[model samples]
Target: MQLIKIDKTQNYIINTGTIAGDMEGTSGGPTNPGPLSIYLEEGRIAAITGTKDDPYRFKQPNRQTTFLDLGSLTILPPLADCHVHLALDGLDFATARRRWEQPGELHTQISTQLWDTVRHGILAVRDGGDRPGIALRYRELVASGELTGPVIRASGWALRKPRKYGSFLGRGVPAEMLDSALGQLARHGVDQIKVLVSGVVSFKEYSRVGPVQYTYEELSAIVQGARNLGLGVMAHASSDEAVALAVKAGVNTVEHGYFLSRDTLKLMAEKQVAWIPTVVPVAAQLTSLHPAPNQDNYVIAKTVDRQLAMINEARNLGVTLGVGTDSGASGVRHGYSYRQELALYRQAGLTPEEIIRCATINSARVLGLNWGRIAPGNPAAMIAVSGDPLGDINNLRNIEYVFQPV
Candidate 1:
């Protein structure tokens, strides 16, 4: 206990043993599910159990103890966001672009965004990319304890081929400069690599999309280059052809797979590449742009339905999936967006447990971190809601408070 730097005079215990969420064992496997008590030792969970009526009364040599009764709250793992752009304020394209030009303002906005995200119970975030190394800087700030926020996994700057709409919040690295660009991110110590293979869907032209940025071979080279530097690749792909091409190149995950076909999804499953549907961006945008069932809203709604069906199909076919709200996209607010994403997944046929698992466990897996789940010996990064989130997914919004990096 002294080595862990926990207060030796008092043993801290959190009890009343309300509930145990998804992961539940020391071996990193599931255990019996029920109300459980967790003891805090050295800022980590020393003991966790559901059977005992008096959980805080544990034997400890030469130690005084204090207990925190959880009462009726639900105990669950910390949530993770698989994709985001801290640089964008999630308002509109023009506002987003203007913010980039004002560096001082941009940094302040990032601080606000990070604070809001973590305060909302998101413990870890994978920033897809942002300019001027803001994402990496924020990650450093979090690591150094200068800022109290989530563990940031940054891609530095997303890569793309030279073309229009290619460098929205990322850099477009030419084919010849692929190795050098990857080296730069590696030098900055990025957690992963993001490369754009296609553009965002155009609201004005409902049937079309942003132009394809990289061919299959080009994307493959970027993947290989990043892998050489010990980084996995995630691609921003939305069209059918672009999604197929990205999967063929062996990117680790595909973002916003809006128009993916069954065959392409099967291919992704075969290759073990996960998909982040990012359904809330569209939902948020559609509601913001045109509340009624206007032509644009109708078209986007239809597309959203198709994408949700494909995601449902992906689950049935055993394709791995991670959830993200694409927070910071147009009209997709950060703190509240993830709840919307979870609701959309539930509407698309995922159970509340499954949706919560995607936001916590599966998202962590995609980010390649050991930060989720409530297991003894694991860090006590957890959240307590006002009610059982498993019973009603909407209760996730009722997060009373969160404790993380425990």
Candidate 2:
């Protein structure tokens, strides 16, 4: 088991026991009927050949090709985390925030988390914005090879209302200064626009979330402004009212859509808006290493159950779902918490295939990438797991190799 950075200039042929295709319109079965010989050229999948037709044809060693024969490993599209806060370390928030003043310490912390994230088979992550634009800075570093990490789609700084829930996450954009604020963010070269539609959900109070921060008009203006700049909006919305507002306003994705009603889910389906139900962050509160004494465990557990039920309902109603561990939030660690998020999806009654689809395909779509599939012309960014992920979703945790293109 190793993490291999693929050299695009070199040719390689990997022979694997099974190769799973994207779970799009049909069943998520292996692309080939039997053992597969996959050809990679210049960082793209050149071809896929099944050994059932001619086993010995590609088995012969050649000088020009780097051959790898994975006996039992299964290859599939690499995973993605749609909503993460790279500035937070899932530990003490006070300590992590204080390090923000020290650039050297902050970079060191973020570098370590990025490696942990990629090692867990997550190749891409969408940073859920930080106030100081720390994640945005790291995105450039990763691009220039100064920092080693996943593909980061960063929201430079989130837009929020004055005295709202997300002071630490981003700047407060007043209604009058909305255009000026967006201009500043666009000039900063943000990959997307993050708007705090509502505040955080409550831990002690069941079914209680913070008030919606933006009116429908304000939110719609933000969404349209972002679109004019060629960016998508990832709305930080909770409760049903906020979720509905974001959907009607044309947000690309809704993060932590807790307490969503059936009608809202139906509306999301109708509008084709993706939902990133960050269940792990809430679930982690109940079992955190450093738990808050004032938190109510029963209330948090019930809240988690309700969210999972909504996730199930969202899938049933054909709402696009993506896997997002609110990493850096209290009790949710990067890289490691991804498996926990998928497990929650399973508890929501999603089968292994469905969970994989959300974690890979749907998440990749949210990140504006053409990945999450292995075929001719697709980028050779895939992962090999020790066991069949289709059989048991936990097998994704056993990442044998990460086939990352250089």
Candidate 3:
């Protein structure tokens, strides 16, 4: 369990019998681990050969190459988090509702959080919502090689109806101005558009979600405008009506479908719209207030149970599910929440392979990144855990190595 450093153009061979990527052989069971010699060229997986094949040779001239023999450790495509808040510190959500006042302090905390996230094996992250300029800077830093972190696909603050929803991580705009709002996000270099179709689920009130923020037509305009700008729209929706409207509007992903019915799940599947049922945020509450549950914690515990049931139902319908931790929310730490979401997915009847797909490949597709696969042409981003995650998904928590742009 030590960190290794190498130059940019230096070639390397990672020797591991366990390779998991490209969504291969993952069908609700542990994939058979075999000998794989992952050969790298210019920081990408140039070739992956098994025992029968000759050690993959790079067909071109190469520099000094080193060999890493990680005999039986599990190697997986670096994970992705489909929804997160880079602005929040995950210290009691009720207290830290607003973005930081000091710009310098915010940058320090967020930079550290991003560092922690990448070090923990997350290679790509879709920031669902965050303060303006904060996520943008990290995106720049990652792209420019000034820092290392998961490829950030930030929404750059969400668009919500003014005067009704609180403005903590996003701005409040009128529904009629949805088109303009999408344009603004695109101009901000957002990789995707986040629309607050409804408020977050209320842990305090039973079956209560925040107020609906956008109408179907309004959401349609937002989605259309975002699409025109070549940006995918991620809808923050929890209520059935909100989820339905967002789906009808053709948003790329639904953030929180906590109360969605099986019918709605079918509709989402039929339309090929991805769903990111953020569990750990509320689960964090449950973790904190268990054994002596308050009304809010009780409601959250019940909601998590229902969410798991719905997630199982979603799987049966062949719905595309992306893993989201809603990190930066109370009790959900950065980097750690990825595995928390995976463990919850396992609890929801998903096998280790299925949870890996949800956290890595499925979420990567939602983020539109050229990742989630350990193929020859893909970026050499991956993580090595101490044990076989395919045997027990919880073993993902034991990250031994994280390979990114280092």
Model 3 lDDT on a 0 to 1 scale: 0.80
* Candidate 2, lDDT over the whole model: 0.89
Instruction: In angstroms, give how far residue 137 of model 3 lies from its true place.
Output: 1.9
lDDT for residue 224 in candidate 1, whole number 0-100: 87
Task: Give each prediction's root-mean-square deviation over alpha carbons.
Answer: 4.0, 2.3, 2.6
Worst 10 residues of 1 by lDDT: 1-10
Positional deviation of residue 247's Cα in model 1 after best superposition, in angstroms? 1.0
Model 3 Cα lDDT, one tens digit per residue, 1-406: 3444334678889888677675755433334366778888887888888888888776655588888998888788888888888878776554444436767766777788888887778878888786464776678888787776778888888888886564776777887667777777778788888878888787777779888887777888888888899988888888888898899999999998889988899999999999999998888777664322344667888999999999999999999999888888778888877777888889999988788888888888898977777777887778888787877888888888887745
Error of 1 at 117 (Å): 0.6
Best candidate, lDDT-wise?
2
Which portions of model 2 show Cα errors greater than 4 Å?
Answer: 25-33, 52-64
Assess candidate 1 and give its TM-score to the true structure.
Answer: 0.90
User: lDDT tens digits, residues 1-406, model 1?
Assistant: 0011234344667654355465524444333344556787655667776654555444564576656676777777778999988877786657767877888887788788887887788888898887666788889888887876788898888887776465666776788888888898899899998888888875545547787887777888888888888899988898888899999999999999888889999999999999998999887766795342333767778778887898789988888889887888878877778888888898899877777778887898998876567766767677877766777889888777577652
Scored by CA lDDT, what does every candidate get? Answer: 0.77, 0.89, 0.80
